[model samples]
Target: MLVQDAKNLVIERGGVLNCLGPKLGARFDYDADLRPLFPLIKGNLANAQLYDRPERVQFLLDGILCTIYAQEVVAAPFLERDQVLRFIHRLTATLNDLYTRRHSLGRNHRKTTMLPVYDIYRLLPGTNCTACGQPSCLAFAAALSRGRSYPDRCPGFRQPIAHHAVYPVYDQNGNLVSTLEMELAADADELNRQAQPTREHPAVALLTAREEEVLRLLAKGASNPEIAVALAISPHTVKTHVGHLFDKLGVNDRTQAAVWAHTHHYL
Candidate 1:
């Protein structure tokens, strides 16, 4: 099966993709054949938001498959042709990073069933004491909901409700995804970690809005001409913006710019 082949390739390349339980979070399982031939649900979700072109998505999937196949075929120990494989791997990583970033920023994936902090606090004993460190239980609960505070900070909730509170995530069909079996606090901790604020690079602020949009496309592994076509701009304009981004970010090449942008949340 193509999915099996993809799995094998990943394993052969010293990578592991495991199906984590609901407590950990929903895992993205790719069917190797389906990945190239069919559109991913996440890609569909992104298309709905105009974050990616369908053709580009297909191309990225195809490139990923090709890279995997190349890795499987070039199983030699010698350095016969290292540069080509390294370039492919870098491109694959950039495409994957862009897909993840688009999914993360999509409004459709936002927590829809999050319980209001006030409601959770109302269930608590209405003590205005600073035991929780925010002057009131409501403040503490709000911070917890925002991922700015942990449940353990609330002295009252630590023992009683910490084990029952649940975070929400939607499956591909818009249904609630079942979390893996785990204690509630453990699940909450995992959720909180995922919700931490991303850090943006200082150089990102130097980009014009148009340049930023182009950069996002580039980070998604779009070629300069492809980006120009998507944005209805000339290829020359795309190259100009690319050059500006490289200068501002102090990078010498597209791959490095992409890596820095992804690492700093600029993409």
Candidate 2:
């Protein structure tokens, strides 16, 4: 599969740009009918929204909207785009290939229900307490929904408040002033809209197809003989493949090689 056609690398409006860094937009090319990419993508991304009928998977990468369509892929920060592309390629290798990692996306691979302020207001204690510096709980809910304030600011929520988090709210000094940062789904997006590019990941590009297969098998705790049997190859060939993977991953042992694969998102 010719996974993607990277049309052009655009440097976003405001910042120092890296070689592979604001965004890469591409018309994805693949036999879409055979692969379960939407489910796989919805499974891998941490923040994702999926539409079942239209077949769209939307997610946020470093605060950028990574909208994936049946025929296209758009993501910001060169490294992120590269990562998504590689992930797609790895998954598309076989119909059964699926990503096994931290997935935080759709609730049911369905459309996102609009969450209005009224719905949030109903969840509040309705105490009308000024303990959070707000005039009332409704006002606090409003602010909380916008992510302008956090739930911990309210003394009423000493216990958990269903789905809300008491994340750290950093001050201008980059010091933790309070653990009162609440993310109400949509409002928890990154504070900085102008995303900065991440460091390059050149390790993935160094591995060959056979090495990748060997790495995947190693990640599954397979031995050389197991891998040989799985790939329909001899144990000696499997050893050679494993050696090449180790050299590329800069790891001496199979365990280290597996760790490298996982850390690099290759597995």
Candidate 3:
């Protein structure tokens, strides 16, 4: 991966980027004989993996986890390809850092031994905030990998750790057009607190007041013909409201619709 090495690695890939997309996705081909750098990959990326496919690997590039294929890759979008390109540049820079360095790496540097801690620190925020009850972020990462530390100590990682979440979506202007939220992990006994169900749920906001009255009556076992009489509306108008209710509630039958009302306390 020398600066002048044309054969280092240049992938052919394509992908899309939406203003409000979940992730930056791309598909690209790697050389058939991909390097066996699992340890190095893990040290540099928050997420990295080597699978049964000997010639392929997946790793985080910027915010994207991109797959480098040995034999096949799928076309995606423009922004995704750009991220992959930047990833290639970073990989090259890493090679430059590795090659010209004079430091003594542990002899043989086999996977049987732990990953180098300094490398582990590379992926961290580098804040050295001591927020994880460790002297430094590096110590925290090592403790985490070794199972000596739980994920909750890092307020930053707690929610994602609990849910195995994807990062939030971003738009082309780098705006947060959509949000993915994760709640902090609660104590083991938090589930024991009993909570009362409340009526007039948020879904009611989607319907007009008149429509909500119709749903309440429907949930109370009123026939469509009966509802028309009580609401002082024609049967045809009642049927129209029922259809509207079904569309908004996403229910196919009277029973399912009634169940929704009961679950949300609309009844």
Candidate 1 deviant stretches above 4 angstroms: 1-200
TM agreement with the true structure for every prediction: 0.27, 0.31, 0.28
lDDT of 2 at 211: 66
Ranking by TM-score: 2, 3, 1
lDDT of 2 at 11: 32
lDDT of each residue in 41-139, candidate 1, tens digit only? 334432211112112121222222221121222121112234334544554454455455544543332221223454455444567675654545654
Ranked by lDDT, the better of candidates 1 and 2 is 2
Q: Highest TM-score: give the candidate number.
A: 2
> lDDT by residue for model 2 over 138-211, one digit each (tens)?
55555454344555566665444234564443445766554443443343343222111211233354454566
Sort by lDDT, best first: 2, 3, 1
Cα error, residue 127 of model 1, in Å, equals 47
Quick one: best lDDT, which candidate?
2
Q: Which residue pairs collide, candidate 3? A: 14-76, 15-76, 15-77, 15-78, 16-76, 16-77, 19-171
Kindly list the per-residue Cα lDDT of model 3 for residues 103-149, writing each as its tens digit.
Answer: 43321212222223333333356687877556557555554432334
Clashing pairs in 1: 21-180, 22-179, 22-180, 23-180
